[model samples]
Target: MALSSQTTALAQIPRVHIFPTAGEAADAVAEHLLATVKRNPKSVLGLATGQTPRHVYAKLVHAFREGKISFCDVETFNLDEYCGLTASHPDSFAAFMQRELFGLADFDPRKTNLINGDVQDVVAEARRYATRLKESGAVDVQLLGLGTNGHIGFNEPGSASDSHVRVVDLADETLSANQPSLIELTSVPERAITIGIADILHAREIVMLATGSAKAGAVRRSLREAPSTDCPASFLGTHQAVHWYLDNAAAAEIG
Candidate 1:
């Protein structure tokens, strides 16, 4: 299927664009996000991790230091985390977000929320997070990075479209590709804690960043596949406002 034909509302897909490199893509996305935050200083943001979003975060940090943006009035909620890891774990999503984004921007620790993988009562923690998001009046804009398996925010293959805050078994392929340095094929974690699809859709706008040749196939599938749980990122096309930013490498299969 063609990307434009994958969803019903192509007119509302926000804007899709391809840049020469990830850096150029990141700069464009960062500029828009920072402008939005500036317009509404108290904006609530949904954040994602992985290599694709690193350059975007770097640009945001630069904006922060250069007096172009401020996180003092911003509140952030992360997408997911490994089920059995602590915030301090080197490979933990929490640590990854801190090192890649929050720490660089000096965002207040209290204003940022990440799923606690170490929480003893997993269900309760998930519920509390959902409550927190609702209390914040939902996310204004969400940043996403697609997995090679077409998963988003840990919503892996077969993940229900209405799936909500909960823990799920990480698809072996997803884990292996995501953290190959720390997890081998056999040692990959079986479970992960992730925000639900409903939560992501609650955002007023969504921005997904994709980079590298490894992501080309998934990026193509996400933009062209039918809106089914099998291709999690495909659901974004159904969202009211979704923007996909891609580098040439990641957009290779677009045609």
Candidate 2:
């Protein structure tokens, strides 16, 4: 298909909307998500953690407080978590999700699913989480945030395109960048458990949020690179329902 045709098809697959700034992008995405929940009260949502998604979570929280949306019947699965941290860890992805999203929404704790990073048999836990996703009929929509290195859900450089539910050592740059908040580079967990590229691809719809000039390079690569494991986010180009919600700064190179 032609490029415009392909973009149109992809938009139909989910919905891609670009905005002037991160806040606008977040607001638009939150509106769409709330509409989906209203239409299908039992929808399963895939959640992602990170600074990029902060505004989206804020908007969702505002809507909830204003009685504009309800998530009581929604089910959620978080994208990744640092492998060795407990849910209580300040820097853990679990805590991030709670502080940023779930705590703000009305979703029941029982309906939310996050990979148990503290599980003794990590491999088995990963498998069980994958199975639960399948049994729950997969995620109706998945929210995503891209790393500056082009990683998505901790699927780092050189990860297999088809890999699923696996443990991976965080890239050096990933650890270094997070050092400040995490106290030290050594304090950052070397490994993490994440949903596989395949699992993320299987979601019914995907909403990828990106912002800031810091993300410009990876955003460009994610849009321009050939679908390859070298840049995990490039695999998203192959996804039928992937929507890139980018701020102007992030989309500068693409434009």
lDDT of each: 0.82, 0.82
Using Cα atoms with residue i matched to residue i, what is each candidate's TM-score against the true structure?
0.89, 0.90
Q: After superposition, how far is residue 18 of candidate 1 from its true place, in Å?
A: 0.5
Across residues 1-255, which tens digit of lDDT does each residue of candidate 2 receive? Answer: 112222322334234556767788788778768877989999999998867788888888988999988889999999988887788777888888888878877889999898889888888888888888888887888999888898999999898888998888899978876676562235788888899999998998888888889888998888878988778999998888877887777777775
How many steric clashes between backbone atoms does each model show?
0, 0
For model 1, residues 1-255, the per-residue Cα lDDT tens digits are 013322223324347767777788788888878888989998899998777787888889988889877898789999988777889887788888888888888588999988888878888888888788888887999998888899888898788878888888888788678665462233656788898887888899998888889889998898888898888888888897888877778878875
Indicate which candidate wins on TM-score.
2
Backbone collision tally, model 1: 0
Worst 10 residues of 2 by lDDT: 1-10
